[model samples]
Target: MDIQTLAARVDEIWAGEEAADARELVKQALDLLNSGAIRVAERVGGEWTVNEWVKKAVLLHFRYSDNREMTAGPIEWFDKVALKTNWREAKVRSVPTAIARYGSFIEEGAVLMPCYINIGARVGAGTMIDTWSTVGSCAQVGKNCHISGGVGIGGVLEPLQASPVIIEDDVFFGARGEAAEGVIIEEGAVLAMGCYVAGSTKIYSVPEGRELPPGRIPARSVCVPGALASRDGSHQTYAIIIKKYRDERTDARTALTSILREGI
Candidate 1:
């Protein structure tokens, strides 16, 4: 069938009254994906548009099914349909040993080191997910990045349209670092070792000369350590910037020293 005809058929199946047939339609779509007849487009505006009958099929499968059930069917379906190009040459650290939950996508050249990549999470090409790291549901990671050991990339799947943690290309996350709740880390960003960044955490910048309020961290900006006002007024938690190292002094020690000297 032609692409347009297939898309129409998929829409019809999804909108059909019967639920069982919808799942079957998804299976047909997967067949198309496996054959390289379709593609999933990641638009600049942050939309993933599927153009192949197979992607439509896989999407429909997840769209109508219960995500809580741990089934090999979904994973097998994706493995058969999702684009394997650009990732075909990618190296996997330990194949057949890495565990990926339902609806998760691990591209070629991406290495999983005994990590848990959960449902709805997508790891881009050449990205290394270190030991014990968690990529939450719907979290989108870009290409050529390094997710260090024990890091948690939070997922926001509830409320449907709510944004998930977005990490762009060439970024590096330190061990035991945490990023949660719709946080957007632009291209080439870096999170220091052991830093914990939440949605409500304010990211203070010394380079941009401004303080980023909750829920947003500017691109290419350096975030240094700072203390937030606690209830007891005794101490505060460390803050960090979510970007790549642009200079030699962008490390945690430099950030702390700068903050103390500047009294910010």
Candidate 2:
């Protein structure tokens, strides 16, 4: 069935009454998710849009699911969602203890190093989710990105209408950092360790020499933690763009590594 057809079925089943093929529809939706045929959200015309129906289908899946016990080499799990087993076909390198829930997609050349990927999340090709990092529910990560250790890419499921976190291609997230609450990290940006980006966090631009607006970090930005000093001598946490790349052909990794150390 087409996405629209599945969407319509989900809406019909969600409205108080259950359809005779509700389980089958939910199964089809999850099957698509497992095969990487559909995503929870995508960028269109430079703007990110939530595929609400897909999220609805994910929510509906939970309603139809029940807890069951699963054993893996002495590790026992009792959960409604089963772990994905198609990594070999997808060419994803998942280390031991790396956990990815059902209804999520991990594309080719992606490495999961003891990380956690929640439901409805889409991790793109050539990306690396390092140890202890989390790709939260419905979060969308783009291709060739490096999500460093202990990072958190937030989910969007509670309100059901909220947008998921969008991490664009070629981005690098340092250890222990968080990009949450509908924040958008554009392509080629590098976030230093301990940096936190949320909807309300202030971002300062170094090349432009001003404070950028919240929610979106511009493309090719090299961001590091900074202190927004108050006039009365107090300070608050913030991210500063220490540098911005003009071309992808440039040696970004070396430049970013040097730039991130400038503030420290």
Judging by lDDT against the true structure, name the best candidate.
Answer: 2
Candidate 1 CA-lDDT value: 0.60
TM-score of each: 0.64, 0.89
lDDT of 2 by residue, 1-264 (tens): 888888888878878665889989988998898778988888889788888878888998888999999999898989889889877777888889999998999988788889999999999877889899999999999987889999999888876648899999988888999988888899888887888998988887878888889999888787888867655867755555555554554445423332221211
Question: What are the runs in model 1 whose C-alpha is more than 4 Å off?
Answer: 1-20, 26-91, 95-97, 159-161, 222-225, 230-238, 241-245, 248-264
Regions of candidate 2 where Cα sits further than 4 Å from its true position: 159-161, 230-264
User: By TM-score, how accurate is candidate 1?
Assistant: 0.64
> How well does candidate 1 score on lDDT at residue 130?
79
What would the per-residue lDDT of candidate 1 be over residues 71-166, giving only the tens digit for each residue?
354553323212232223434443344566544667655777778775556788678787889988667788777788899988654444346677
lDDT by candidate, in order shown:
0.60, 0.83
Q: Root-mean-square deviation of each candidate, in angstroms? A: 9.5, 5.4
